[model samples]
Target chain A: MAMIVDALSWVFLLTGGFLGVSGGIGILRFPDFFTRLHAAGVTDTLCAALILLGLMMQAGWGLVAVKLAFIILFLSFTGPVAAHALARAALHGGLMPLLHRAEDDPSKS
Target chain B: MRHIISLTLILAGFWLLLSGHFVPLLLGLGAVSILLVVAIALRMDAFDHENQPLHLTFRFTPYWVWLAGEIVKSNIEVVRCIWGPVSAISPTRIHLTATQRSDVGKVIYANSITLTPGTVAMRLEGDQIEVHALTRAAAASLQGGEMGRRVRELER
Candidate 1:
């Protein structure tokens, strides 16, 4: 049972790490600011949740698990609010998004 | 009255969970601090139902589970959009009318929009929210009103 639990925890940790890395790459590669926010905000919450869940499993039934749960809850609640505020600020600052229009050719227009 | 009781309980529970020390002196200190915090909150007139929201505890769990699923699905879509051709993303501004009745519900709806990948609620005025979506598909999904409906359900 202990071996199985350890293996499961490893799987979760590795997957969470992979997601986090991909999100970082997405933030760098995305074209504009808003899309980059999408990359950062979405995966940040889920990746943290997954990693903390793995840690909670490893912690077993204890205060550590409770603390991990609290952290996850806090992140989920705050992440969106922060994203909203950032987007609002950017919009107020007149950061227009680069819209992909159909009539505009990629090379010429 | 109920709000005050719930807030005090929540604060005390948080203190116990965070401290993890059962010594009499530490516990006594925790109690005093919690009381002080509650007193300040009450004096500020921030102990209303909207602020505390103890009633939504039971309704929020299922909404959270569904939201987690939505987040995972949208995250995959966003990852693909990032790796795929840049032209695939069509950034668009959308105006959505929030169907929620209360300010709390409207805030939840807007936050949920911002929480999901590819969509951000940029401005909220009255019952209308201005949003920016990374792609047309995401904007269409927001127009579908599933999340708004879920938030309305949560309000009840």
Candidate 2:
């Protein structure tokens, strides 16, 4: 059971790390600010949650687990609020999103 | 009265869990701090139904579970978009009408949109939320209004 738990923890940790790295790459490579925000927001919350979950599994039922759970709760609540505020601020600053065209704009194509 | 008791209990429990110290001095300090905070909150009139929202406890859990599932699903989708070709992303702006009656509901709706990965609630004016989605599909999903409806349900 111990070995299996360790292996699972490693798996979660590695996957979370991979997601974080890819999110970084996405932020750098994505075209505009809005798309990059998506990359950052998505991975920032989920990656932290996964990594903390892995740590919780390792810590067992104790103070560490409680702390990890609190961290997860805090991240889930604050992450979205911060993202919303950032996006709202950017919008107020007149940063227009790069929108895809379909049938509305005939002059472009 | 109930809100005050619940908040005090929660704060005390949080303090105990985090401090992990049973020393008399620390315990006395913790009690004093908690009381001070609660007194300040009472003065601020922050114990209203909307502020504490003890009524939503049972419903909020299931909503959180559902939101978590949606977050995970959207995270996978966004990850694929990141790894795939840049052209695969069809960025779009969408205007969604929030059906919730209260400010709390509207806030929850907007936060849920932002939490779902591919969509960010850019601006909220009255009942309408302007969102920037990473893909057309994501925009369409928001247009479906399932999240908005669920949040509206939470208000009741």
Candidate 3:
């Protein structure tokens, strides 16, 4: 049982580390600010979640695990709110996303 | 009245769990601090249906689990796009209909959209939300309405 838990923890940790690096690469590679937000969202959401879940497994069933759960809860709430506000502000400031088709305008009636 | 009690209990539990000091002085200090915070909340009129949201508790857990699955799935897709050619990303802007009836439900839907890695809810106006998706297919998946349907179910 201990071996299984250790293996799972490592799996989650490694996958999270890989995703975090990819998200960083994505931010650099993406064309515009809006698309880059999607990359950063990857790091904040699933990457953060997996890393924390791995830590929780290491912590076992205790108050430390509970605190980790709270961190995940707060991140899930704040991550999107921060992303939404940034995206909203970017749009309001006239930063247009580079679309597959330029004619497909979101602001047009 | 109910919200105030719920808030107080939650605050007390949080303080106890965080502090971990079982001494009498700490307990008294915690109680006093909780009372002061609750009093401030009352003065600010923060105890309301929207703030407490006790009605959605039972239903929300399942929705959250489903959303976690969605996040993982999209994280994989976005990661693949990241590692692939830049042209692999479509970066499309689309509008989705917020099928929820209440403000809280709509906010949840929009936030859920934004929470997923490949999509961001850029603008929310009445029943519509403007979304910027990493790919056109991502936008199409959202239009399928499974998530929006789940959010709608939360309100009931």
Candidate 4:
């Protein structure tokens, strides 16, 4: 059981690390303001979730796990909502849309 | 009502974890501390989130872990940008479109933008973010779509 838990932890840690890097890269290298928003949100939500989950497993059955779970839940709900608000603000303030590359524009109109 | 209890439990649990010992005195102290904090919270009227339960947190832990790495990476980038030769620096202003609708999300996005290397969220005027980046690469990073998409996913 301990080995299983340990393995699970490693998986979670590695995946979290990978996503964080991907998100950082995505935010750093993507093609527009809106695009960057997507990257940041992904990193905030998904990357955070994976990392906490690993901590929960290592914590085992206890308040530690519960607290970790609480954090994850809070992030999941709050992360996107915060992102949404930020994005909307950016759009309304007349930030540049990827005129040539926005797949969302045609869909919105 | 429920939120109060929930908050108490959370506080107690946290207190215990931090204390890491279970003598009668410690346990009594933990309970008292939890009560005091919860009382203060009540006085502050932090009731809305008191009822918040742990929900779907496990689902995104991995992503958060990865975010830590990004923070670290960005830290390096920021240091290099600020400390490198002045000739390597290029001050720029860029506007990125926003696609979110919640205040919390907006703050997080803004903070994250500032947290990353080479960028500062100078203004969040409506939908456009007036950002200042130390370099073109930093400016371009603001243009990326991944952050926007990820934030949207979290909203869902």
Candidate 5:
């Protein structure tokens, strides 16, 4: 059971690290500022969640695990709020996202 | 009244969890601090249903689980778009009608949309939310109304 927990923790940590790096690549690869928010969102939400969950698993059932859970809870709450604020600020600052209109795609009616 | 009680209990639990020291002196200090915080909150008129939201506790667990799954799914999609091709992402802005009755529910709906990668709820005015999706597929998924419906359920 201990070994299994350790294995699961490593899997989570590694996947989270990979996703975090993917988010970085996304920020560079995505065309515009608004699009980059999505990439950063990936790191804030799932990547953070995975890393914290992995740490919680390694900590096992204790106050340490409880504190980690609280961190996850707070991160999920604040991450999106911060993202929304950034997106809104950019929009209000007259930075228009390069949008793909439904008319632009001939395939969609 | 109920909100105050719930807030007190939550703060107490939070204090205990953070401190982890059961010594009488520390516990007494924790109690004093929690009471002080709660009193300040009450004075500030912050002990309301909207802020405390004790009613949502039972229902929130299931909603949170569902949201975590949605986040993971969208994360994978966004990651793919990152690695696959720049042309793969459409970057569309769409308007969504928030069907939730209360401010809390509407906020939850908007945040859940933003929480899922590949989409960000940019502007929320009254019953309408302006969202930017990384791809047309993400826009289509938000148009599905399933997540919005689930958030509405929490209000009831």
Candidate 6:
């Protein structure tokens, strides 16, 4: 059981690290707020949630577990709202999304 | 009333779990958690209906399980898009007029929209959601309307 637990923790840690990296890279490399929003969403839900679940297992029945669960609950509820608000704010601030050239052709527009 | 009790118990139990002992710590946590439960119950304009069939839990579990699979699938899709010569991710804006009634139901709908790959809920203007989708497929999925229906059912 302990070995299995250890392995699971490592797996979660690795996934979290990957997500952290992906989200970070997306935030940096993505061209627009919308694209970056995709990155940020994945990081929060997939990466962060997985990592925290792994950490919760390691914490056992202690307060760390309790605290971690609270954080996860709060994050689950708030993360999407935050992203929605950011995207709206960005749009309101004049961040026009880039369109595909063919789609952007004057005939289409 | 019911929610307050459940909240108090959960908070106190969690507090004790974190504190990892009994006596003064446990009792003190019990007092604090009870206070907090009362406070939160007041804040939400909440009522005694904590007994509502945790339908969202049961409903969204499978939806989320499937969603996780969908995320992995979409992640692969996005990676493919990013790696291509043109990085041909077509950024498109879409308007979705929602059918969900309650605020919680609307939220579940919006979050589910955000949860799926390649889409973001830009804003909720009344009953309509302004979405920025990364591709035509993503935009189409939002318009398909299955998720909204499912969330509406869950809310009931």
For every candidate, the chain B TM-score is 0.94, 0.88, 0.90, 0.73, 0.95, 0.76
Query: Quick one: ranking by TM-score, best first?
Result: 5, 3, 1, 2, 6, 4
| lDDT at A67, model 3 | 93
lDDT of each residue in B21-83, candidate 3, tens digit only: 889999999999999999998878854535566557667889888998999999999999999
Give the per-residue lDDT digits (tens) of candidate 5, residues B42-142. Answer: 88885454566666887899999899899999999999999997899998888899999989899999999999999999989899999999999999999
Task: Pick out the ten consecutive residues of candidate 2 chain B with the lowest summed lDDT.
Answer: B46-55
- How close is candidate 3 at the interface, in terms of C-alpha RMSD after superposing the true interface residues? 0.9
For A2-98, candidate 5 gives per-residue lDDT tens digits of 9999999999999999999999999999889999999999999899989999999999999999999999989989999999999988888888888
- Comparing 2 and 4 on TM-score, the stronger one: 2
lDDT of each: 0.84, 0.87, 0.91, 0.62, 0.91, 0.72
Worst 10 residues of 5 chain A by lDDT: A100-109
In Å, residue A68's CA in model 4 sits off its true spot by 16
TM-scores, chain A, per candidate:
0.87, 0.89, 0.95, 0.86, 0.90, 0.84
How many Å off is the CA of B130 in candidate 3?
0.9
lDDT of 1 by residue, A1-109 (tens): 9889888988888878877887898888888898788888757677888899899889998899999999998888899899889988887788866666644322110
Where is model 4 more than 4 Å wrong at Cα? A1-109, B1-6, B46-60, B125-128
The 10-residue segment of model 6 chain B with minimum total lDDT is B47-56
What is the per-residue lDDT of model 2 for residues A1-109, given as tens digits with 9 covering 90 to 100? 9999888988878888888987898898789999999999867788888899899889988998999999998888899899989988887787766777753222111
Query: Which pairs of residues clash in candidate 2, taking residues 3 or more apart in a chain or in different chains?
Result: none
lDDT, model 6, position B126:
83
**Runs in model 3 lying further than 4 Å from the true structure:** A106-109, B46-51
TM-score of chain B alone in model 5: 0.95
lDDT of 4 by residue, A23-82 (tens): 676666655665465456556755687789899888888777877877886675566556
TM agreement with the true structure for every prediction: 0.91, 0.91, 0.94, 0.51, 0.94, 0.78
When 3 and 5 are scored with DockQ, the better candidate is 3
Identify the superior model by DockQ, candidate 3 or candidate 6: 3
lDDT of 3: 0.91
